[model samples]
Target: MSRLRIHRFAFLGDARPFGDREVIAEPREALEPRVRLGERPTDGLQAERHFAADEIGDGHGQAGIERRRGGRVHGGASISAHARARPGRAQKSAIPDNPRRKRGGIVEVPFRLRFAFAMNLSLYVVTVLIWGTTWIAIKWQLGSVPPPVSIAWRFWLAAAAMFVLLRAMRRPILPPRDAWRFLVAQGFALFCLNFLCFYYSEQVVPSGLVAVVFSTAPLLNSINGRLFMGRPLRQSAIAGALLGLAGIGCLFWQQMAGHVDDRATWIGLAIALAGTMCFSAGNLLSSRMQAMGLHPLATNGWAMLIGATILTAGSIAAGLPLAPDTSPRYLAALVYLAVPGSVIGFTAYLTLVGRIGPERAAYCTVLFPIVALAVSTVFEGYRWSPVAVAGLMLVVAGNLVAFDLTRRFFVRTA
Candidate 1:
């Protein structure tokens, strides 16, 4: 019987044999054999090949020796270990796949979710800015043309623009027959009466004041939602409503005190309040239309056309001159209001209402006033007295309270 010589060697950190005792090798003088006495098949050749590759260029070094100790490679290296081992390659592969890890810590937001959050935020900021600056443009449309005719021309251009856009995009122009009734109602409330009231109100009051009054839409929306949609009116909403009302009273108190006998101020206030209610009603209608599977852009296109038609017919009947304003300023303002204000602003806002419930989305009403007031300060000479500043703060506070953002802020701080 031939005597078998068994050899054992420590593979860096692993204390194990690399080969089986089944294959007996002739004692070679070239390299020392580090073999274990075992019946398992030897992985010595494979280990030698891996070790040679590691020493030459692979750079795994002693780690590769430990990996092949038990006749197979182990895959228990942590992310940090892999990153440290292959800094460049591991960084490229690991961080993006596990978006949870950043700067050596786990953050846990997936790439797609982060992208969607950014998109929603962008839409929100765009909507607020467009609607905010739009009030000043409405002021420019006041002269030469009656509010009805100006409103008519505005929506007609918007409708034409939207229709052309829809055609170019290959989107359907007409809605379902059942949606027509809702569309008509939406046309009347949103595009027709709401704007009519706002334009007339701006004629009597400053456009900024009109915008301030319109800020009450969220409160009205909460009420309408409770009445029509059977949604509960939370205590925060009621508190917000009270604060908003008090702020409005504060805003108008000076005007009322100075000119108690002026009836036009009262009328403007009433009209603005009515317009806000109309806007809130339209919000509910839009929510209903979306629930019925209608896209806001499509519904808005048809509704704007219908509204323009009605306003045009009413302007003709009332004997208001239906001619377009020829002045450069008026024309430019009209185009801006039609395209960005009506088309883009309304679409973005209603889209938000559809995505995040109307109550939360209506916070745009609160934010728009700040932008409007800033523009008013620059263009309309809207001086900010301490009283006006306090009223504005109260309005902002109301928004924070209603949205539960105030509570969230305190919790974060705590």
Candidate 2:
């Protein structure tokens, strides 16, 4: 081996000369010249790798290339002296290391990090299950209560519960003035008009079908974001939108085809479509609010209150009685919708948005339709035809494509 000098800071020994291919593997305490080392030099300290002059280089044996480029090589490896060097108060030295863990040592996976993954997974499950089942709960409220009045009760209870939760968590309940206007828009679109459309639509169609329709919100958001916010539309999003639209068409083929079935089927589809548009609009407003430094939870609480107020006022003006249904099932459904559906589900999903990312958290939209449809078969006595099954497949496939999950999985794994 060609002679080469490897410089290591003060380890457990004096300045040592590295022989050809000699590896001085040991616990090393690196210190600056004439500067005292810290009390815990071992804190996050990594090992230094020495290499023979012939060990690292291109085919032409340009081992000094790194040195010529103001750095040095290590152990015939890609990691260089300049790459892992940490600057201390007095001295900086090159070391072979991993930012996530120490090199050639214990892989320090933190206990909290493992739990963090579990917690996020739990949040995703709860959000999907609760939102999906709430379709049946919405259907339950339809028998006795007027749709507007029922929604008012749900949001009033939900708003109160959400405010209490925010207080317990010590988050500020009132949003900034800038966020209030957007909150109003979000409330109308998300809480009031969105639910009103769905509630009315469900009165005519199966609740599970409404969920399949609502699953198109992501596509709607993509389209509206492009139209209103000037975001570039992706080709995949367009393809997904076309597939989802075709699926909706198939789901209502007989009804829209003007056969002998209920005429309200087509009307229900239109209403659900309008509601999805409102939902997509609300999502954009929420994005704007988030950009203004508002937490979605805070805006959601305020929006629920505003939406409840609007629904109550609208109900009174329309001469609908404000009293809630006295039946046990109705009351139970109301509480479930208020607490778990709106408050808990929203909290979990938004938490996931913050933790995993809005992109991944929104995948919950893809899973909940299956849960809703499954619940529908048992409770609503909804029979799935071959066409309906095909529609469901298309919708799910479109969501997967729209989300670019294939690309994402490959990117992460790669």
Best by TM-score: 1
Model 2 scores a C-alpha lDDT of 0.61
TM-score of each: 0.68, 0.65
Candidate 1: TM-score? 0.68
Q: Give the range where candidate 2 is weakest over 10 consecutive residues by summed lDDT.
A: 53-62
TM-score of decoy 2: 0.65
Q: Report, for every candidate in turn, its global Cα lDDT versus the true structure.
A: 0.63, 0.61
Each candidate's root-mean-square deviation in Å? 21.2, 15.2
Q: Across residues 232-345, which tens digit of lDDT does each residue of candidate 1 receive?
A: 566776676567656655654565465445688778979999988888888878777765556678888888998999999998999888888899989999999999999999
Residue 55, model 1: Cα distance from true site in angstroms: 53
